[model samples]
Target: MSFIASIGQGAINLYHRIRWVVSISTAIVQLAFHPSSWTKPVRAVLTRQIVFTGYDAIGFVAVVALLTGISVVVQAQVWMGRLGQSELLGPLLVTVIVREVGPLLVNFIVIGRSATAMAAELAGMKVRHEVEVLDSQGLDPLVFLVMPRAISMALSVFGLAMLFVVFSFGSGYLCGAFLGTGPGDPGIFARSVVRGVSSYDFYNILAKTLIPGLLTGVIAANEGLSVEGVATDIPQAVTRTVVRATLAVLVVSVIVSVLTYI
Candidate 1:
């Protein structure tokens, strides 16, 4: 009886979370497409979000990507040579660096940096009744606040993923040249990369990056907005946002990887 009761309670909790996710996701979509949501004040909010989430993330993302690239180049040279497939260095780099590592790392960074911050900020507003104050003032908080942050966050993550790809792959190329991977021939490196990464790979990586960004932003916004009562709720919301964002990204990445093959 005890086990059965526990199972039922777990399902009930899951159902509530699913409902919240669906409701907030629909709200974000509606506001994202609604032109009325983009007034002057909202635009200012959006611009600030872009600056904070996107521009601020660039330096760290670049450094991480560069380091990854350098490591990949060294490994690719050794492994490919041992396999007697040294000519496949570019393709190996493309697959490991661009397809998997780049998107995953950028998404992780954004979740840690921006998602937690957004959750705490929104929770703070809620705890202070500022969101309710906006309600009384005849402004929809969704339009005034949440949706812009969601959209900006998604864009920021996507932009950062691109930066990751460039710096990581570019650094890998430089590493290869320095180590004479192609015996000082850049053409070999270029051809391998081009041949290795197909149009399908391009589309798949984009989907992986874009979808996760949108989901992370929406989930973080939802968690923050759901906070109710007390000073302690803010920290709790922030922690939940981080955990949920990490799990959501992992699930979405797995689904994309499977769907691409199908």
Candidate 2:
């Protein structure tokens, strides 16, 4: 009975945590669309977050994309060629890279790199009572701290995911051509990939990136802010941010994939 009771308690805790994150995510979106929320300070913070989460991480993201393209794209091309279904290469790559891999990888990278850092930074601020300090100065912590960071995360993820798709496809094409695995003609390869894309793919990519990115940002911020002014708990908060954000991304991705089919 004790074991069952503990399981029930854990389930309840999970439910409450998810509800809180969703509620905060909705609030962040609402605040983001309000014209008055765009104060100079808020804009500055948003810029900094973008630079940190998106721009500075470009090189790393590109390298990962290049490697991924070399592996996944090249393999798809080679297999399609062997199977005498070279025509399917474009659709296969589009499905694997654009509809799935690109967004998921970019979101994971942002969560591991920027989200963890954001959580730690916020947790440190909470531990030092800086959040309270801002509150004392007539600044709402949600608007001054959370809103900009969360919005920037969503924008950054979407931008980086687009770049990932482009870079991955380009690297895959070049690698395939050099290795004699691809069609070898740039025009043919371009046309094939272009033919494979459709309007649903555009919506698929958007839903996967923006929704999960927003949820990830909210999870990180909420965990960071949940710290009770204890320095020792900051590390725990960062860990929770990573775990929760990763789960949120996966759950959102699976839901979007299902809805795309429906």
- Per-candidate TM equals 0.92, 0.98
Residue by residue across 1-262, what tens digits does model 2's lDDT show?
9999999999999999888888888898899989999989889999999999999999999999999999999999999999999898898999999999999999999999999999999999999999999999988989988988888899999999999999999999999999988899989988999899989999999999899888888888888888998999989999999988999999999999999889
Per-residue error (Å), model 2, residue 140 = 0.8
Best by TM-score: 2
Report the Cα lDDT for candidate 2: 0.92
lDDT of 1 by residue, 23-90 (tens): 87678877778898788888999999989989999999999999988888767876787889977877
Alpha carbon lDDT at 222, candidate 2: 86
- Best model number under lDDT: 2
**Model 1: which residue pairs collide?**
none
Lowest summed lDDT across 10 adjacent residues in model 1 is found at 180-189
Q: How big is the RMSD of model 1?
A: 1.8
Task: Quantify all predictions' global Cα lDDT against the true fold.
Answer: 0.82, 0.92
